[model samples]
Target: MSDKRPLLDTSDIESEKDGIMGAKESSLLMTGITYKSTTVAPTVVWYGRQLLVRRKLFVGLLVVFIFSYFLIGPADVLDLDNVDSIVQVHHQSNVLDREVNQKLLLPKGYLVYSNQCRIVDLDPYKREVMRHFKRVSYKPCKQRLPLTQMRYDDHTRRYVLSINSTAFQSYHVKNVLSCCYMGVERVSESNVSYTHCEHFKSKAQISNTTDSVIVKCSTEKGQIYINGHATIPERLQIRQRLKQWKRRDQGRRVPSVLMIGIDSISRVNLIRAMPKTAQYLYDNDWFELAGYNKIDDNTFPNIMALMVGYNLSNAMKYCNPYVSGGLDKCDFVWKLYKKHGYVTSYGEDAVKINTFNYLKKGFKQPPVDYYLRPYLSAAEKLLDGNVVLGLPHCLGFETESEHVYNYALEFARRYRNDSFFGFFWTNTHSHGDISQTSSMDDYLKDYLQRLLAQGTLEHSIVVFFSDHGLRFGPTRSTWSGHLEERLPFLFIWLPPFLRAERPEFVKALRENRNRLTTPYDLHMTLKHILTLSGRTGKLETLDGAKDCPQCQSLLLPVPLNRSCEDVAIEDHWCTCWSYKAINKNSKTMRHLGERVVHYLNDYVTSFRNGSLAHLCQPLTLQGISAAYKARLSDDDPSQTQIYWLTFSTAPNQALYEATVRYNKSSTSEDNVQVTGSVSRLNSYSGEADCMNDFAIKKYCYCHHKSG
Candidate 1:
C-alpha cells in the first residue's frame, strides 16, 4: 500500500538543480528571467526634408492630407469607454485568449494604456516587430532572490519536503510543525546547503530544524515538510469522517460526494494516479472528476470545455489564461444536483482564471446563458442548500496556494454530510513560478502522505486531476505543437457499488492499465458520479461506467435546452435564458470573435478623440475609403508582393497606430476595429534596412531602410 522509492541524494548533483528525474520528464524544469510590468515611452523622431527638389514634387498635398485626417479621425474618437455606449457588449466566443500580461505592464483595468504608446498587440507571426515602446520601464515584483531547487523521491516510509525561501514576505512565512508521520525516520543528509531564503531573509533562525538527515521550520501560517523518506495510508480518512455523520445511515440514496484533483493529470499520469485512487474507492467511494477536459488537444481550454462538451479552439487569441473555462460554451454541472436537492461547496483558491468573470462562477455562454444557483436546478435564483465557499482564484502570481488547500480541508471537515459536494482546487506552485513536475510531484506526494495520515482520505471517492499540463517554457519546440494537450491525469477513487455496474470500465482498467483517456468523456463521467447521469443512469461502479462496446451514445448529453425552441441552433443546446438569443435570432459571437470587435470601438475612440487623427486628415481626407477598407486576409502580408505596393514606410520607426472601422456584412453599422503597432527596435541614424533579417520563424528582424 506504500512506495519504497529510494531517496534522491543531491550531494553529487550540483546546487543549480535541486533534483531532476530521468532526462525524459526533466525537460520541463528550469529557472529563467523574472517578469514585471512597467511604463513605455514614445520614440518619435522627425526627419526634415533636406533638398529643395522635394518641395515642388507634390501639389496641394496639404489639402489632400487635410481631408484624409478628418475621414479617419472620426473612427479614432471612439474607444472602450464608449464601446459600450453604442454597442451591446455581448460575447462572441466566451474564450479569453488575451489575458492581460500584468507582469510586463501595470494594470489600469479594462480601458487604458500608456500615453506615448502606440496601441500594439503582442502578435509574433509576421516576422516583424510587435512591441509598441522603445523605452518602457520595468520594475520587478521583488528584488532578485536566491532560488533553491530540490527534489525528493519518497513513499510509505520517511516523509520529506524541500525548504527554500524567497525575498517576498510570504517566503518568510513557513508552516507550523503541528504534525508528522509517527513512523517517519530521517535517514541521512550529506549535502545540506543554504544561502538565506531570498523572500524570508530577515528571519533570525534561517534553518528552523535541520539534522544530518533532514530540515524543518515553523512559521505562523502552517506546517512545512521537507525532503525525507516516509509512508502514506492505503485509504483516505474521508470515509472514516463520513461515519461520524448521522446522515450516512439516514440516506436511501447517494447524497454526498468529493471531487479530488491531481494537478496536470494526463493520459500518461492518469495511469499512475487513477488505479490507486480507484482501489481506494473500490473499498468505499463517493466522488467525481476533480479536473476534466472536453477536448484532449487544448489544455488551456480544458476547464471551460469540461462543462459543455467541446474545445474553444484557436479562439483564445492574446495569451492563455490559467484554467480558462470561458474559452467555450458550458454550464456548471452542480446545477443538476442542486435541483435534485444537494448542497455544494468549493474549498479552493479564488478561481481568478476567469478574470473577466471569476465571481460569476466563471460563467461561459452555456448553451443557455444561466448561472448555477444555490437552489436546486429546478428553481431559478434559488438556493439548493446552505453552502460554504471561498474566494474564486483570480489565478495568477499571488501565493494563496496553502490557503486554498487548507480551505478545502477545513470545509470538508466542517460539512461532511450525506447531501453535499465539495471541491478543493489548485493551479499555482505548478507552472508560472516553479517549473518542474517531478519537483511538483515531490511536494504533492508528501502532502498527500500527511493528509492521508490525518485520516482525511478514505471511503470517499477521491477525484484528482489538473486543468491541463504545462508547457515547459517558451520554446522553438512549441510551434502549435500538441504537447500541452496530451498529458493530464484523471485519478478517481470509487467505492464497490460504483464500479460493479460499469463492467466495460472495469475491463478497460483491468485490460492494459496503460492506454490513452482524456476528459473527453468528463461531462458524462461527472454526471455519472454525481448520480445525475441524466439518461445515462447512475453507475454502480467503475466496471459499469465503462463504454460498453455496443453502447452508442455512451450517455453523452445533448444541448441543454433542446426542447421547443425552433430557431436554428448548433452543437450543444441549452434551454436557459441566454439561449433566448437562439429564439430571437440574435447575433451570437463565436469564441470571443464578437468580443474582439466589441473592444475595437475602444481603440477607435482613442484614435478619433486624439488630435492625431484630425491633423492627419489630409492624408486620407476621410481615411481609407469604406470601399477600400478591405479585410486582412490570413496570408502573411509582408511575404506578399502586393504588400510592397500597398503601403510604404522604411522598416519601422515611431510606433504607428492606425484605426479603421468596418462592419461585417452580417451586421450592418456594427463597427469592428483592428489596431496595429510596430516595435521601435534600434537607433534610427539615417535609414535602416526595413526588411527583417530572419523570415517565417519568430526570431526575425524587420526595420526601416533610409538611404
Candidate 2:
C-alpha cells in the first residue's frame, strides 16, 4: 500500500486546520494521494465522507422547502392575499349557474310584464298627475278642549275613561258630564242598532261596559256643551280568552295576525308614495309578494276574495251582501281565528266607501269580537270633520285614518299577550288620488316602528297590504299603471320564532315572491296560520280556495308556470301576460276595437232581460286610441291572442278599455269574445244616468243624452 496513511504534510495540516486550500491540493489530501505522486486515482474514496455530509445537508434543505411550500399553501407561498377571494369567486360562480338554470326553466313571458312595467319614482306621467294635487304640509288636527280620554291601565288590567274638566273651564260653561254605554246591536244582516243609553259614571272602570260609549256634557239649561265618543278595548276579556285557549290547547303556539290594508295603492306606487315605509319594510326583511295580482276591478270583490276566499260569482251566490245575513254564512277567515280562542277585530276608514259597506249591506252582526264600525260611525256623525280628496280626512281634531290606526295600536297593545286577529284598513288617504298616499308615509312608518318597539310584532304575523291600484285617473292610462293596477303591494312578516322553527315555510314564502299570486292564496295563508304549532314539525295540509282549487298558502310555493286562470284571475285584471303596442290604424286593430265596442253594447243590452235596449244608445267605435296585442307564453297552446283596446264610442265620445281574446285555432263565429267587463276610462257620471245597474252603467249611453 506504500504507507496509505502516509505522513501528512505541514502545509496540508495548516491548510486543513484553516479550512482553506486549492481544489487539487484539498482533493489530493482527502484522497490520500502522495505529494510526490503525479497521478491520482479517479475514485477519491477519502473525499466520499465529506461529499456525503454535503449531500445530507442539501437533502434536508430540499425537504424543508417542500414541507413549507405545502404547509403555507401555494397562494401563501406566492405571497398572495386572496384565499377567501378565491372561495368567494367559486361561490358566485355556483350562484350564477343556479340563476341561469332557473331562468332557463322559467316559461317565456313569465315575468315580462314586471320587467316592462317598472315605474320609477319620478316618472313623467306620474309626476304630471301629481301636479294636479298640490303638496300640502301634513298638520295633525289641534287637540280640542278634551271632553274625554280613554286609556288602559296595565297594572290594574282595566280601561279608565277620564273626563277632561278643561273643556268646561276653558269655555266658561258649567255642565253635568253624563256618559252612556253604546253597545252595537245587530238588528238585521244589513243593519245595526245602538243599544239604549245606560247611565255610566265618569272616571269609572268601564272595562265591563260596551266597547264604545257616548259622552255628553250638558249645561244647566239642557243645551249640549260637549259631546264626544270613547272606545274601551276589552283587554280583560282578551286575557281570559287566551288563558282558556292555552289550557285547551297546551303546547300549541299560534302567531297573532295583524293586517294593515291601504286602498288603491299598488306595489310600485307604495314604493313611490311611501318610500320610507317601503324601505323600513325592506330593512326589516319583510317578504314581498312581487306578483300579487288583483282578482277583480276594485276593492269590494278583491277584499272579498281575500276574506272569504270566493270569486265574484261564487261570492255573490254564497256570501251575498245584498241578502240578509248572507255575509254571516260566508266563511270569513277571521271567524276561524275567533273560534280558535283568538280575539278578532276589524276596522277601516272612509265610512261612506268602506269596503264592506260601500253601496252594499255590510255585516248585520258584529263580524269580529271588537268592531270599529260603531265608533267610526258615531265619530263621523257627532264630530266636526272636513273632507279632503272627496272623503272625510279628519274627525274631531284627528285624521279619519288616524282613528283606525289608533284603534289598531290599542287593540294590538291590549292583546299583546293573547292570540288575536286584526284587520285594519285605511282608504281616506289613498282611495281618491294616488298622490295623497304620500301624506300617510311618515305616519304609517311611525305606526310600524311603534308596533316593533312596543313588542306587538314579537309573536305576530303582520301583513301590510293593499287592495288595488288607481282605478280611474290619468295614471291609469299609462302602461305602468295598467300593470300596477293589478299588482297591489303585499308584504308579510313572520316572527323570529316561527322563522326559526319553520324554515321550510319561510323558504317557500321567499320563493313564492316572483310567482303569480292572488288574494285566494292569501286566504289559504291565513288558514295555514291556524295550523301552526309550538313544536318544530312539518306544516299541516291546507285547504285550497273555493273558486281556485289550485290556489294554496303563500307560505307554500306557488308554481312558476301558474297563469291567471290557475288563480281565478280574469283576463282584464291579469298582468302576467306581456303586451306590445300595436298600430291603432291597422285594420285588425280597427276590427278588434269594433268588436270590443259591440261587446260593450251587447253587454248593456243583455242586462235586465234586454229591457234597456231602447233606453241605452247603441255604441259605435269612434276610433282606436291605443291598442296592444298580448305576447302569449310558451305554455299557452290555445293560440289565443288577447288584444287590449282603448277606444272611444260615438254619441258620448266615451273612452272605454276592454280586453278581447281572439282564438286563432277556433273556426266558430264566437272565436272573438270579450274576456271580462269593459272599463269606462272616462267619467260616465251623467252619460249613464238612465241606468241604475252599476255594471250596465259603464257601457250604457243614455238615449235621451244622445240628442
Candidate 3:
C-alpha cells in the first residue's frame, strides 16, 4: 500500500523539535508545504494563503466595525440627554385657572388671617392667640431650654435654677409658642399640690427661702428639665414600670436594630463626597440599595412614610407633620417595637428646628425609652451663644455630630444583650445647607468602622441613610440635581448568621441592590423584623409580593419591572422619566401648559373647599422655561412631552412643570388627541413672587413685571 501519511521535512522536524508545532500542526507541511520555527514558511501557498487572507480580512473588518461603532454610535450614547435639553431650552410659560380664596382654615388657636404666610409675625399677635391656648396635660416634654437647668433642692426648699441666657433663647422664650412656666406637686398627693408657675423671662424672680417643701418641679407644658427629673417616689414607680416591662419581654429573641441617618444628602452626592466611605461599607458585607428614593420632597413626610408605613398625604390634608396634631398620636413604628419589649430610642440633633416640632408642638413626654431631645436641649443650653450659630454646636462637650454618634454608639453598646431599636439623625452637619456635609464624611465613616470592628452590630440590623438631596441651591437647577433631590442613600448591613441561614434572602437583596425602593419599603422591612422575635426564632421568608401597592419588605423580591405609580409615588414627585416636551412655542406646547394649569387648579380646588382655595388670580402663561421628551423605558418606543412653564397670577408668578402625552397618530396639522390626561410634575409655589427679586430670578422673569 502507498504511504498516505504526510512526511515532515527537516525544517518541519526542527519546528516540532523547537516545540513550535505539535504533530497535528506539523501536518501542514504536506503537499509542498514547509513550516519553519519562526519565519513565515512556504506552505501550499495557493490554498493556505487564500485561507490566511480570508481570516485576516474577516478580523480586519471586525476591527473597523468596532472602531466605527465606538466613534459614531457612541456620540450621545453616554451623554445625559437631560443635561443637553436643559442647556438648549430657556423659556416656557403656563396658563392656570384663577384660584379664589375662601375662608382660610387655621389650626385651633391660630389667629392669622391667611394660612399662606411663610413666617408668622408674632410681636403683634401674641395677645390675641394666647387666650385660645388651652392647657391639656399630655406627655411630658423632654426638651430642655438653652439656659435653664432645674434641680430640686430639699435643703433650700426650692428648685435651684441655673441658666445662661442668650439672644436666641430670649427670642424663643418670649416670641415663639407658649412661654415657659414652673409648677410643683407633691409626689404622694394628686389633688392638693402646691403649684407656682411663671412665664419664662430673663429677670424672673425665685424665692429661695428656708422652707421645707417636698414637691416635684415641672413645666406647665409638661416638660421636665434636665435637673427636674421626677422625685424619689416617682423614680421608684418608673423603675417598677421598667421591671414590669422587662418581665413582659422575658424569653423573647428579637434582634436589635440601629438606624443612623443624615439629612439632605442624595446618594449621588454621598458617593461623590465620600467615595472611600461608600466603598468601605460595600466591602464590609453591607449592601447598598442604589435605587432607594425619598417618598416626599422634605424630611418630615419622608420620615413619616418610613415610620408609619403610609403615604404622608393620606395621613393629612397637607404634607407638614404639625398640620395634623403633630405626630404625638400617630402610633409610629417605634411604638410597635416598644410594645414588643424592644428598648426604643429616637433622637435628632438640632433642637429649635426639630422636624417633629417644626412650626408645631413637639411630643409631650419621652416618645422613646431614650429620647435625645432633652440631652440635646441640655447641651444647647450649655453651648456658648456665639458658637451656637456655627458648626459643631456643643453636645455635652463634643460637637453636635460627635455627640449624636457617641449617643448611638453607647446605646448600642449598653443594649448589646437586649433587643433594642435606636434611630439617630443629625442635621447639624447637613441640614439646610449641604456645603459642609463633605467634612462629616470622615467622622461618620470612622464611627461606623469602629462599630463594625467592635462587633457592636454583630446581632443587629444596621441602616445608614439620608432623607433627601439639597433643595435650595444653584445645584437644584441642574437636571442631575433635580433627580438627585429624590434619590437618598440607603445601606443596610444584615447579620452574617441571618444571611447565611437564608441564602434566598441574600440573593434577593443582591438582586434588589439596584431596584427601586422607598421609605415605605423600609417600614415594611421593620415590620418583618418585628415578626422575627420569640423563642421559636422562626424567620419567615421576606414578603415576596412583587407589585405591592403600599410597601414591600427588603427581604422580598421587588419586581424588576415596577413603576413609581405602582409604589405609591405621586406623579408630581415621581423621578421615573416618562415625558418629553414639544417645541417651546409650538401650539401643542402652549395647549399642554394651559391644560397643566387648569389641572393644577382643579386638583387644588378638590382639596381646598373654602376661601383658602381661591387665594390667587387665574394663571396666565409668561413663557416656557424648558421642555423634555421622556421615553418610558428602553423597550417602549412611545414618548411623552414635559414642559416647565412660568405662570403669573396677578401679583404672583410660579414655576410649574407638567407632563402631557399625545396620541402617536395625531399630526401637528390635526387637532391632537390626548393619549393620557395631563399630569403636573412639580410646582414651585414661591419661586416667582412679584415682590421678591430673588424668587423672580430663580423661577420667573423680572423683566415681565407688567404681566
Candidate 4:
C-alpha cells in the first residue's frame, strides 16, 4: 500500500483512465452506438463481432448442405415421368417468374384460347388431362426363347429353319424339333385362314412363293408340342413383279412414296410424347402441316379419306367395307400407283384392329404386293406377348411395332432403286396410353436415321403421320383433348434433290403449313407425287377428293381464308373455331345437357331400324359437367352460335360429350341439333355387350344389366 501511493501521483492515474475511455468511445462510434458512460460499450461491441462471425459460418454450412442435397438426392426427384410432369415443372417455374397466359393463333382469324383448348406444349392444363392415368414406361416382357428360328437366304430365295438345342434342353424336352409350314390364304374379304401343314421336316428349306408362313414346332411324337412362329421371308421378287410394269421409263426419276402411320396421336402430342422423333423430323426440315384436321370421328373414316379420297357416306356407298370384296372395288390411290409401275406394299401391326379388317371386310385379294395381314394374323396366335394398355405390346422377342418397322425397312431396302409406294401403319404402341408414344421416340429416330444412311430417301418421299388423337381416354374429356382429337400430325419429307430442284413446291408447302388442311388434301398430294419429275414447271393436274373437290395437293399454296367446310371437315372435328367456357351449373346449360341426353336416347332408340330400342335402356341426364360457347370471328359470319356440353348419364354414370348448334334465329326443335357423333367419354364395355355396332354401342346401356 505504501509503495502504490508513492509510485503513482493523482495526475498519472487520471491520464491512464482518460486513454482507456477514449478507446471505448471510438469503438462505440464505429459501431454507430450511442450509450451512457455507465453502460459497458466494449463488452457489447465484442459480443456483436462474435455473433457476426457465427452467422457467416452458419450461412456457409447451410449453402453446402443445400448443394449436397441436390447433388446426392434420389434420381426420381428430378426425373419427369411423362409429358404432364415436364409441363408442370416448367409451368411452376414460369409461374414463379411471371404470369403465363399463352394462346396459339390459328389462321383465318381464329384463336386457340389457353383457357379453353391448350395445344401449347408446356401448358399446365396438360397435367389435368394426363393426371387421370399413371405414367407408363415400356417394360417389355422378357425375350421368349423359341425352339426354332428362321433365316432367309437371299441367294436361294428361300427360308432356312433351324432348331435351338439350348432352348429344347432348358425345357427338359427332346431336341427333336419337327416343323411344318402352314400356308396362308384369304378365304373371304373378312376372313384370313391358314391351311394345314404341307411340308413337315426337322430341317426345312421353305419355298418363297408366299410372303408369310406359320411354322409349327413340335416333338416327333406330335405330343408336348412347342409354340409356333410366324415368319415373313424378306425375298426380293423384283424381277418377277417388275415384268408387270409396261410403262417403265429409265430416263426420268420418280420419287418413291413411304407412309409411316401411327394411330391416335395429335400434332401437339407428337412433340410432347415423342420429342426425339419430332426433333429429328424438325432438324431434317420435314414439312409439317399445322392445320391437318381429321375428316370424321374415327380411324375408319379419316383413313378412308386419305386412301380413297372419300367421306364416310361416300365410302359406305362405294367401298362398303362391311360387304365381301367391296374394298377391292373402291378406287384406292395405291391402285393408281401400281398401275403407273410403282411397287406397292401395305402393312399394319395389329391384325385384330387393322384399318381394313376391324369389324369390316378387308380385301378379297391382297391389296398390295407386300401385305402384312397374313403374317400378323398368324403372329397373334403363335407369339407369346402381353396386352398392355388394351393393345398387344410384344410378340415374342420383339415388340409388335418392331415387326412392322423391320418389314418396312426390308421393303425399302429391297425397292430402294425402284419407284415404290409403301404404307405401314402401327397401332399397338401409340393407340394405347399417349405416354407410351415416348417409348417410340428413340426407335423412330433410329429408323429414320437408318433410312437416311441407306440412301433410301435419296429419291423418295416419306410421310410420317397419324389418324387422330386419343379417341378414348381420360384425355378425351379435356378441351385440349377435344381439339387434339380433331387435329392429327402430318409430316412430309422430300429428297434433297427434289428440294433443290423444286424450290417452289417446298416454298408452297412451307406456306401451306398454317392453312387448313385435311386427309383429302393428303390424298391429292399422293396423286400429285405420281406426276413429280426431275424437270418441274407445274405438276400435272390430278382429280381432287370425291367429297372435297376444293382440296388440293400440299405442294400448292392453301388459301388463307379456307374454312373447315371447304376441306370437308365436320363441325365436331373442326379445330379452326375457338370456344369460351360457360357456367356449367346455369339453367341454360342444364337444359342443354338434358336435350343432348334426350337426343342420345332417341339416337339409340332409332338406330339400326329400332333394333337397339328393346335392348338398350333409355338414358337420363345425370348432371352437367362442363359447358362452352363457340366464339366465332367476323370471318365466320354464316356459323350459328354453338355450344359444347359434357354431361353424365344415369344407370351407368356414363359420360357423354357433344357439340350442339343453337339457332337463335329459328323457332324450331331442330335448331338444337348435335353437330357430330355424340362421344361416349367413359367405357361402356360390359353394358354394350349386346350390340356390335361401334356407333350405337356408345349410347346403349343393355337392359340385361341389373339397375
Task: Give per-model TM-scores.
Answer: 0.35, 0.76, 0.58, 0.78
Best by lDDT: 4
Q: What lDDT score belongs to each candidate, Candidate 1 first?
A: 0.29, 0.70, 0.52, 0.71
Q: Which candidate, 1 or 2, would have the higher lDDT against the true structure?
A: 2
Report how far residue 281 has shifted in candidate 1, in Å.
12
True-structure RMSD, every candidate: 25.4, 23.9, 22.1, 16.5
Model 3 Cα lDDT, one tens digit per residue, 537-616: 33344332222355678887766656666677654455544233335677766666666555555544453353333433
Worst 10 residues of 4 by lDDT: 1-10
> On TM-score, who's better, 1 or 2?
2
Clashing pairs in 4: none
Error of 1 at 680 (Å): 22
lDDT tens readout by residue for model 1, 168-236: 344554443322211121221111233232232222221213211222334566543222211111123
**Following a full C-alpha superposition, what root-mean-square deviation does model 3 have from the true structure?**
22.1
Model 3's number of clashes is: 30
User: In model 1, what is the error at residue 500, expressed in angstroms?
Assistant: 6.4
Model 3 misplaced regions, further than 4 Å: 1-253, 317-326, 378-382, 385-397, 535-550, 578-582, 598-608, 611-620, 633-707
Q: Between candidates 3 and 4, which one is better according to lDDT?
A: 4
Tell me, by TM-score, which candidate is best.
Answer: 4
lDDT of 2 by residue, 450-544 (tens): 99988887899999999888877766765656667777889999998998988887778767766778898998888888877432223344445
lDDT for position 641 in model 2: 86
Q: What TM-score does model 1 achieve against the real structure?
A: 0.35
Q: Which stretches of candidate 4 lie over 4 Å from their true place?
A: 1-125, 130-135, 144-154, 159-181, 189-204, 216-247, 533-541, 635-639
